[model samples]
Target: MLIRINQDAHPIAPSEITPESLYRGRRNFIRAAGLGAAALAVSPAFAAAKLGAIQKSPLSSTEAPTALKSVISYNNFYEFGTGKEDPARNAGRFKTRPWTVRVDGLCAKPRTFAIDDLLKLAPLEERIYRMRCVEGWSMVIPWNGFPLASLLKQVEPLGSAKFVEFVTAADRATMPGLALPVLDWPYTEGLRIDEAMHPLTILALGLYGEELLAQNGAPLRLVVPWKYGFKGAKSLVSIRLTDKQPATAWNIAAPNEYGFYSNVNPEVDHPRWSQASERRIGEFTKRKTLPFNGYADHVARLYAGMDLRKFY
Candidate 1:
């Protein structure tokens, strides 16, 4: 007799799929996922297949996402707005079946990619990292996805391509967040070429080992762990590599409040709040914010010549 493998049982997050052999798990894990308990549930044996439970860095324990924290608090689908539970409550209206990413500007091979095409390019890996938010909150997200740099490299940046700009999906009906003039409805963000290539930055499709939900910017979103949460724009619909710095949504909202860099610097406080302390979401919001979101050593060099305060 052959055991029937259920797809949802072994439903690993899109980015975590490749880090381990998804098919190698006990068939029971797959059955469990399909039992209506949850979708994309993984077996205990496969949990450690990626980065596992070890904190990516000592500074980020509170910030690093864990198995428990990953599911309970994650999925930043802001289409429904800023409510923490909005995504889970209101994101179902989003239609993600025919998603596509249009890539253009300063590249030899400009093309549109189906969501699946991008998923297949890189095997998913779960990375536990500090996620600093401008709202003085942070989380240790066990993010699953290949580095964003991997995808940017495919289009091949030209000599003048200095920035990477991402545009969000434009559907105001489902995404009530777009209804407000909060940074031009369809959100957008940009990173300097060097920052875009940072190893820690990720174009994530899911969190906590499952496909991203609609309110969580389903289909695709960026996770730049070192920057303020808003810096990692969501609901990406287009990517453009430009010679000039594109006007980012948050930066445009309040230039003084948000800088182009938007790096998580406790020393440089947001105009509205102290960046010194962040509520690591599930961790009671009293956690101290780490410099560079605990990736300063890996990302500090990118800002070598200039003062972060001035640039930010």
Candidate 2:
């Protein structure tokens, strides 16, 4: 049986590989381990119960953790820069101290918000979720934060507000990737207002009971588990309530590759690879992909009477 990670024959010695190298884009480590297609449906919790002493629930009986922080501090928050770990390392340079969120468009509370002010209003709760990327790697991340719907409710979405758009900070000097036209920079992503209000959708502030690491989209980020990773924008700078569906970064670039609604469907294949299976981190094993990333029970109703195949 394979005991260590990495497929390269001349792999660097373990002492030479730093902690940072253990993770790059969150789930890259999944590939290093032979997380094969053998055990597809089992989650980490099952394995833990059978093995070591189970960790006591850090939360109240009323609350359960999302998933363990499967991947460490890694993100694609381009505002801090590119490279998997760049955001976590460079995000501190961003002034989160007096951060402001520019709120405009179709909302009653059209105003600017001090970052601290927003954090203070919500009753924070931790949700342990299995975050799966479209790239076929997965991680069980225990994301700590409050329900995002609570924030949207505060904005008092207008009747005409059909969608929500997020724009990240755009100082090209600090964010070298801004010069690339591959994507309209400052990186913008959005969700239908209905999807924005979904309980699973999160405007996350912290993780693992600590303030968010800069690379993990410090200050604020969006988390939508059922969809692919990109749906969750990081280091949010502005929020706009729109009357029509906003042009999203991934969908705009390749409509065929990414759909407006990026739900996790094992049957749907990305342009580059099949989504029928995924490699879950920590487990060092492969797992089957669920219809909606295993949140189908919670979110299936949202898409009732609709065809996921066509939208995905």
Candidate 3:
């Protein structure tokens, strides 16, 4: 399942990687600032726990990971709020434990898995992936989880199943933004069955060596490195396999701007903006956006004869 990288082609300088000490220090700083305490007030549900025995995946990108601070602080979790800083600032009291994810529809062994049960489904892997947003921003994230195909296999998708749908949690009490009619409530996303089975698609449980924070889709979330960041649904509540393409939140909200495939294609520009280049969160200058966010070699075949501009 490994996608071999040509080190010479994508050279990662030693200075580029964020120091582990610095990553830990940032979390400590957050705790000292009372954000950690706020989370503890609701319960230890959002408390960060270090994932044990994480296996490093060969499918990982060698690029330096974005700073933990920026990764957590700047996000697009609209359930919490519309502003970039809103999720981090507002999700402190959100509870994530005692969560369950139901996997059903067109499956032989449809079942609901507790958060703890899903964690034990497969050995966790640390995959450093480059995540690109349709808005021309990108980040390298060290995501900890297993390939989503492992979970799908357990449910035993039927022959009739051709797509996978993800439903995200939308607690009105905790997620203030849910009150706003921005898109549909209980955010949903979907992928073609083959895309769901891709090795590059993972069900992320944690990031940066620790369990995810509430703002960053704690408990469980989808991570498709070859696709735009919005394709990665957060705080997942259910995963359904079906024969038809499921309705996705963004595609429903604005079909002209968001496509169902949502692959990172630089050639197909967003209606209001060009997608040829992107600004890395901490970088000064914009870098040329690569096809499939630079994972084209590993995933382009999935689309073979289809026109990307048309499908996109």
Point to the candidate with the largest TM-score: 3
Taking all chains together, each candidate's TM-score versus the true structure is 0.78, 0.75, 0.87
lDDT of 1 by residue, 1-312 (tens): 236799888886878755345565655676676477433332221221222222232323343454453443354545566677655566546666578999889988888889878777676766777766677766666666778888888888788899999998878777776676656657789999888888778887766666665655667788888888888777789999999999988778788988899988989987776788876555543867778887878888888898988987
- Residue 116 error, candidate 1, Å: 0.8
Superposed model 3: Cα runs more than 4 Å off: 1-46
Rank by lDDT, highest first: 3, 1, 2
Local error of candidate 2 at residue 307 (angstroms): 2.1
Better of 2 and 3 by lDDT: 3
- Candidate 1 whole-model C-alpha lDDT, 0 to 1: 0.72
Reference-based lDDT, residue 14, model 2? 75
How well does candidate 2 match the true structure, expressed as C-alpha RMSD? 12.2
Per-residue C-alpha lDDT of model 3 across residues 1-312, encoded as one tens digit per residue? 337799899999989999999999987886776474564546333467788789988898888999999888899999889999999888866788789999999999999999999889999999999999988999999999999999999999999999999999999998889999997988999999999999999999999998888878988999999999999999999999999999999999999999899999999999999999999988888999999999999999999999999889
Question: Where does the lowest 10-residue lDDT sum fall in candidate 3?
Answer: 37-46
